[model samples]
Target: MADHEEDDLRMALRMSLQHSPPEAKRSKPRENAGVPTVSASPEESPEVKRRELMAAAAEKRMLMSKSVAASKPEKSADVAVAENSVLIVKDENRVLGGTVSEKPEAVCKEEEMKDVNFGEELPAADANQLFSMIFGNGVSRDILAQWSNQGIRFSSDPETAMGLVQHEGGPCGVLATLQAFVLKYLLFFPDELGKFTPNMPSQNLGSRRLSESECVTSGDFASLTEDGKASALVRSMVEILFLCGSKKRAVIATFSVLCQGAEEQSEDGQKDEIFAKTLEGLPIESASDLQKVLRVNTCTSQMSAFQQLKEMLPVFQSRLGAMLFLISALLSRGLEFVQADRDDPSPPLVTAPFGHASQEIVNLLLCGKAVPNVFDGRMDLGGGMFLKGIPTSVEVGFLTLLEYHNLCKVGQHLKCPKWPIWVVGSESHYTVLFAFDTSVQDENELEQWESQIRKSFDGQDQSGGGGFISVEGLHQVLRETGINLPPEKLDHLCSTGFIVWSEFWQILLELDKSLGGMKDSTGLMGKKQFDLFHFNGIAKSVLNGSQAISGVESPLQRPRLSILRVSVPPRWTPEEFMADIVVPPGPGGNDPSGKDTVVEVTKPEPSQHAPLVDCIRTRWPRSICNWVGDPPSIV
Candidate 1:
């Protein structure tokens, strides 16, 4: 009963507390765990201040711990952090100081040693020396090795100067032609050759000493560095005199020397006799007016010298002039400068004149050989140089002298008048020009009048004036051929407003070369025509509606275009024809014919009387008899 009364009293107290006013609840304290929590006075503030102070103290302790950790390197992480700090400071210092760390002195020494290689040996010859100056010794050595194989004899002895080049007996005309060819090579050498500089004396007298003031040019060409110009002219004369455009001419020029049986021909008559006999069969049966010195029998020799030359080759490497002539007659590789008269543009069949060629032909053979080409700063050979195959003992000396003279003019940029005055040989007297000019002058004019004309502005106007085309026009044309160019460089070709049609055509042809790299292949026009012929043949076979039918050749294959215009039916359509035709099975995949399973057709009958269409539709397989579907036609 007493417990019940206490429970009742506790219930009554809870009810009274629950019914208490809002002012009493405001001062209530919360419980911690199961115990009632104590409260601070209002003036002293709540426990939040104490908690904030505690947190401040804890933060201070944490900061102290971090400071201690940063001060020491007890762990891997601490050492890493220290290193990072050092690096950051270093970077900042570098940025602020504007300087870089220097490489070790030893490293610089090693690099210097590698680049210079001062311990290596220098080149022995000027040719080799020039190569060394440009490239390393390795390339120089290789070029030297090649030069030795070229079979040219270079002698320092004064007595051997005349005999430096071998003379093969044949038509003196042949030698003249060979000489002209040699001059051609000489004129082109500066543009054709590379860093293979030959040996030359430092004292270049003929051309290198020319001055711009004398030529009325603006710049001081004399002051320019000699490396580019000097390298081109160095020792070029001997090479030009000794070599021909092709080795065949060189061999013919040197053939007698090649056949020389050790003893001198002048001392022993036996070798001369053989050489004369050999010359009996050469293309040159008689001597030209210029060849009187050669004494090749003009009256009685009947054998074909051209025939003999065709037979001589790797078997014999001498008298290149004779061999070249013979090869020209036999293989018909016609001259690069001269065109063949045959319908086929390719090389022609051998036709030996046997001393029957015309004077005009002979003139064409050696036309400009007497004159060195005057290149108008442009690398192209403007005037034709008559390069004869044969060269006289004195001619070699003459060319050598001219070589120096021309070099000085070019190196000094000596204008038109100061150009080379070359000496060219002829039947009677040698034609030596003190000043070489190309402008058309009245033949009857006096030398003084010609000299005055050369200096006048008229000569300047004559330089390059005519119908001209610019590089941009060519670039536009190249775009049509599917070549995309940005730099659009015209190699070895300069822009001119007055280029001749022939020269303009050459430029177009040259620019077309860049189109070779285009995605679509550059097929020949003949190849395209052939493809059209084949396609027409296949269409005719399809139109015939037979599996084993013979194909009709396209009118393009005919020599006459009138056949295409008159023979092919105007109503013919390839697509409709292909639709009507049915192809039959072919031989097994193992067969060598092709991968397609096409049926074999009978050989087409070539009939002259029959219509070309019927002739083309001679045979067809039976499988095409059922393909009756109609298709659209492009005709």
Candidate 2:
């Protein structure tokens, strides 16, 4: 059956080839030239046609045999096997040629060339998809669309468009682009942004030292030209993102070395192979030009660098320039040059999620060796340096910030940051919250009053003054200072009945302005009248969404109280109270004097027992006790 099918197939192929165009016939192999080709008429029967095809095929085989014999080579078995393989391939090609109408040789060569150059061309990618993938679920198409509506174009210019086309999309490219976008967004909406002085050295040549005047505010940034903005963006990425350094001197120094090397190569007319390879196609002319392009000093230099950075931005989009730029910047200065004074010794960041940014990244932005946790960042190392903490202000989510306030023991610095702005991060996105009025940050007068009040409480309290005072003690202090709370309101204010320093501070913060009229001799609100209403608005704004009370509540909620009362014999005198209940029995059980043998119990000083005493008085105000001299406080 197979042999019959093969014969039919061969006949069909021969018929088709015979009916082919004249060009195909001329293109056929030399072996077919001498064969007697028969033309079958349309009227011919199938049997006659088959017979003609079979005879023509036999003649073609005979001609092939004659050609092989005429050019037969004296070769080994291996060479013969190779020749046989080649002939088999050629026969297959020829058989396929009837329908294909072209030689396979040229096609095969073209396909091989395509495979070789496959990596040369950039992979196809949509700019939006690339960004979405790199930024993960944080940045979605909807968010990109929103940004687009706000005039943020992913592909703004021809260079950026082409760059996005060829962009090697990944976390690094996305991060760089995101940083650039953030800076641009700030520039676009300067009113929405707050001024902050990053803890980095000045980007100037004459004065490398950092000072308060070196602050780069939104106004300074907004005042820049388009070119200046671009230059600033690149400089920020290089110094903050790539190097992760707080020192601008390190970046400038590194670039200066590269410029010097390029200059030497230019002067000697014998380029260093390494230098030449590193800067192959870069159009750097002279050392001074390179300096102006890479470093920012005066306005002129910044504008010059802007032009160079604009061209380089595209290159950065299509390449992982973070590590490369880092290495180049640190070539002249060692890695230690960019190291933070105190940094996490863990391995560098391999991944950056929305809320869980790397410590280095946070440090670069916040200007401190910050811990990753959302804590107050305060540690008492037992010196005047107790005031030193991490970031004065931090960027955190709303819920995270709430937790920081309610659940965490937040420090003064974090509680009242220098700027009235926060970078709020959500589950899927990041946004900014800022105050239009900057006066909210100036709580110096209020803080000084708070400090004096805290000191006064500490002096009066006997618990070694660990920033806590009793509710009754605080009430007495407030009443003495001329601001009186109703008894029921006091209970509501302090649900625990024993107010800590924080609770006391909060109560003062929430006080009404009418009660803030009293004043002391010094004229400051600290010694007498605590005019906390001055910052009440500021406090409310800062703590807008951070309410301590959560969950369901009734219209008339009962105050929470924790109290323990120990019943004692009713008619006991003051000495009996101390002797019988307060003091434990002696090791010998009892003394033999028979007057219910008073046991001498060693006790902490009355001042040391003040906190316990205050707790007792606050909890059981109805209880009566007779005292000799100053009554012994509860301990």
Candidate 3:
């Protein structure tokens, strides 16, 4: 609005109007610029001179807008389209790109208009060099921005999605668990998962490289089922991260595992090696042996078949797809990764079936029962695909799975990830590496701790009185025991004051099953079978094959909470779980402690143990201490 700025804007407007079609160029000057104005002396401070330039730039932006409007008068229905919308400024050299003294109202107004609707064509912004590489040709900055908006939106940011509500549990409880999983593991290992990501199609664009496909920006991904959405999002993020190898090289350097093949030295080398080993061993593989390894209860008094097979075969690690859905399911409970004694602090290690350590998860998934030691073994890294409503382990080899997109790079070293193409032979293909982890296993202290909880709270009636306890009874017991359950969790577990103790025990079982994510019966519902953890009804057949492990029911049967197995996990205290936020490794990071690095949940010593007498006192304040007969030392 300054005099000099107005004059500059008038000149620029006239210059820009000259480019318009003859019919649109009959605009007359509205202001008289014949009058001379006092200009700043050369001796003026640099700051003042810079301010004038910024003012002039601001005016030029307005003039550019007006000139563009004048040229596109015939197309009046869409004011923002045609000539003025073109991001070109006349006399580009004379334009000041940065107008620090004044805010660019024209750009702001344009941005506001662009943001009015998600359906509006997003004017391309600046290209984020990193995303350009990660997204490849298939994805664009607009797409990434849309995807990110789908995950979390801010109140201050333009409303394209739901606003983010950050709190103790996060906007959605699921997102918190997802974050924990990513920050803890997925981020650390992108070697194999990155290959599936879509790559950039072209090298150059405006600010943001955009995908031509509308599907890339559509919110259809959000419409999928919870599990499906989680899986797709994680897979996409991984692919993006994989493609970002060039931009995120510093992070890659840390996670990159050393490869034995000198030519194949990079972060992705570890997965490549695993794939090679599995490929090499596949020619001599036995189908029956593969089936036997997935069996949970191979026999009585014997560890699971997985354990036996691992003992027999060389436990080769394999790279599987990022099973983000399953991992989310496991973490839905909490962030614990191992079931260790809270009283005794130690770093815990994950054994077989990395994430699927919980039976409740199995039971919920309609994967009725597990093989005897299936949880004790690794997950079915490549459990094939489900065939016609039935889960089946995959028998396909790696060679057939390749896309051979980069055939020229076959048997060659990769310097940086570009297009994510892999050369197999005469063809270029995609790497079909599955995820595998030998570290998934049951915690050593899981059962012992379960036993302790049952001993403390279980009001015994050997004659099979249903394990019924009122919520008030539980509340009284919890107070006496000095334990606190989160109010929300308590509300979910208890409805109308009564709860079956067996159901509570199922929570403990899930803890071991979920590594350490769940402490109680949380997020349990009817769901389909997950064969990777061998939760499908297959375990029922396998368990029936065993000399009938007493009390272990068939997966086909509905969950029977009335029956109590000899093995039962107690109501694990959340206090103990909180103590294990971080665990330091053993002396040399070996299995010396045979436990994961977790902070110990402090258990009250015998001296501090709540006396059964005290728990009864709350409800029976006036009753006599003697209940027909009592132990000699009641305390």
Candidate 4:
């Protein structure tokens, strides 16, 4: 019964609880196993004040714990903290900031630790930092190390360092430093740049002194320092020269002696001989050739020699004049040898007269020497210059002097001539040497020989002239043959040796006999036949042969027209007949209706025969007619 009553009461309580509105449930405070609890009142309860003090003490302790924990080495937070109310707690002495706290000492040690880490020799670390700084990576380290092995150091100047960065096996800083060091080092020895300086005295200068005015002055130089540097360099060079021995010094001394001697003597044949001998093997055949050889062989030294010679020339004119002649002589002989040997070794065949000769002749043949070409600046014997196997007038002039003076020997050494005379012709000239044998048997043969030679050289004897043919014969040939050639040209052919006079006149005479004479009856009768013999009448011949009389001006009416008449030769072929035939008179003649009349058809003859004959006639027509018939005054 008691148990039932207990259940009913429990049920009643549950029913009451179920009817109440729901609210968040508060977590139950965990109970401590044996901790004490205190109660407190509002007013003067020591419990309230004590609780407040305890809470304050706990807050202070929490603050102190946080500070000490922060100072200790950090640990995982999950293992240190537990539930909302504290459960297990460490002993206060076991935590940080214990009663015998080492905080001040630890703080001092931390600061001191920094100093120890920084101030100590950490060589390995420092090396790493330096490597990284220079190389960026390890690429350049080996090269730098090699440089360091050689004891090179870095440069402070960035530009110089950068410049050395590009050389193979060269570290940037090291090479610049080395280069700067060398450059600074070189400042102590100033002789390296001496070679580039001007006005350095040649070694020969030790023996020769310059005038005061000619001496080079350092003040005149733009850079006095550079000049001093140059002088130091030159002095060093002089020392080297001195060490090289007196042979070089002797040569310089000799050159100086010669230069000084050149000033004094003014005329040194021996010196010139030495100069000429130097060029003995050279192909110098003239003064010009010698000059050229000198210019080439001496290189730039010749320029100095040239200046010196220029200074000397004016004062030694007489000596120079003789030397110039000697040079010319030497050159001429050399040139002759070269020229003569050009074709073959055989000597040119020479015909000459026999006579007693001089030593020069013997010298020429034995030595194969060419005579020196002498000149006096103007109108001199222009040397023995030969052209077309003959010597020119100027060459002969010199030859005559040697010959007249008996300076040249004949037969033994020099060639002699039979005669001193030169043949002159109307239009040509010839050199003749009469080499006669007095022992010849026939006088006629000798006379014939002389005649033949005279003819060979005679231009005047060539036949064809104005008086050789007759004008009457020319006019007749023109009438006989219609073919025409200009009279002036035909006359020239006869007179200028182009045609024989006899042949020219023969055909013209035949034509004159065949046609009787040319008719002036083509009468505009003002028109005259052109005379082919005259120079001005040439165009008239072509006109007469082809032109219409109606359009032509009358020549007979005008005296000028008469003079313009050209007596040209008629041109006809064998195919054309030469006979008399009737033709109607032209308009205005007696046959007003133009009736047929009998006229000679002589104009169509053999053109070849007539023109050549007319050519002879027109050239010497008077002489020809007089020869054929009763002599006429025309000749």
Highest lDDT against the true fold, candidate = 2
Question: Model 3: which ten-residue window has the lowest total lDDT?
Answer: 530-539
Report the lDDT tens digits of candidate 1 across residue range 524-554. 1101110001001001112322422455432
Tens-digit lDDT string for candidate 2 (148-254): 11211123232122011112112222233234324432333333223222322232222122122432332222233443344444544433332223332332211
* Better structure of 3 and 4 per TM-score: 3
lDDT per residue for candidate 4 within 1-635, as digits (tens), equals: 23322332332222222322122222211223122333343336653444344334334445544576679764343233322212111121111111121111111111212211111222344324322322233233343332222211112222122111111222211222122222211222234333432223222221222232432221121222433432332232222222121112200100100111222223545444533343233332222333332211011232232233233222212212222222222222333342342222222111111111122211121122322222211123357633211122110011122322344222211122111111110011111111012111122322333344233323232334333324444433444444244566456544543334455433433332223222222211111122111111101112321234567643321000111122222222121222344454665665755576656643433323222232222222211111221111100
Q: lDDT per residue, candidate 3, 1-635, as tens digits?
A: 34544555555434332322112222323365242333445335554454444445556466665676578553322133332222211111232323111211222233323211112221122112111211223333332322222222111212111112221111122222222222212222223233332332223321222132321222112222322222333432232222222222111100011112212122234534543453333221222222222211111111121122222111111211111122222222212311111111122111112211122222111111111111211234456622111021111111111112222111111111111111111111111111122111122244344555555456532325667677766665455544455566568668756767776665434443333323432211111111010000100112231335676655332100010011112224343432334443556675575665543342222211113223222211211232222221110
Off by over 4 Å in 4: 1-257, 261-324, 332-635
Cα TM-score per model:
0.19, 0.31, 0.18, 0.14
Give lDDT for model 2.
Answer: 0.33
* Of 1 and 3, the candidate ranking higher by lDDT: 3
Compared with the true structure, model 3 gives a TM-score of 0.18
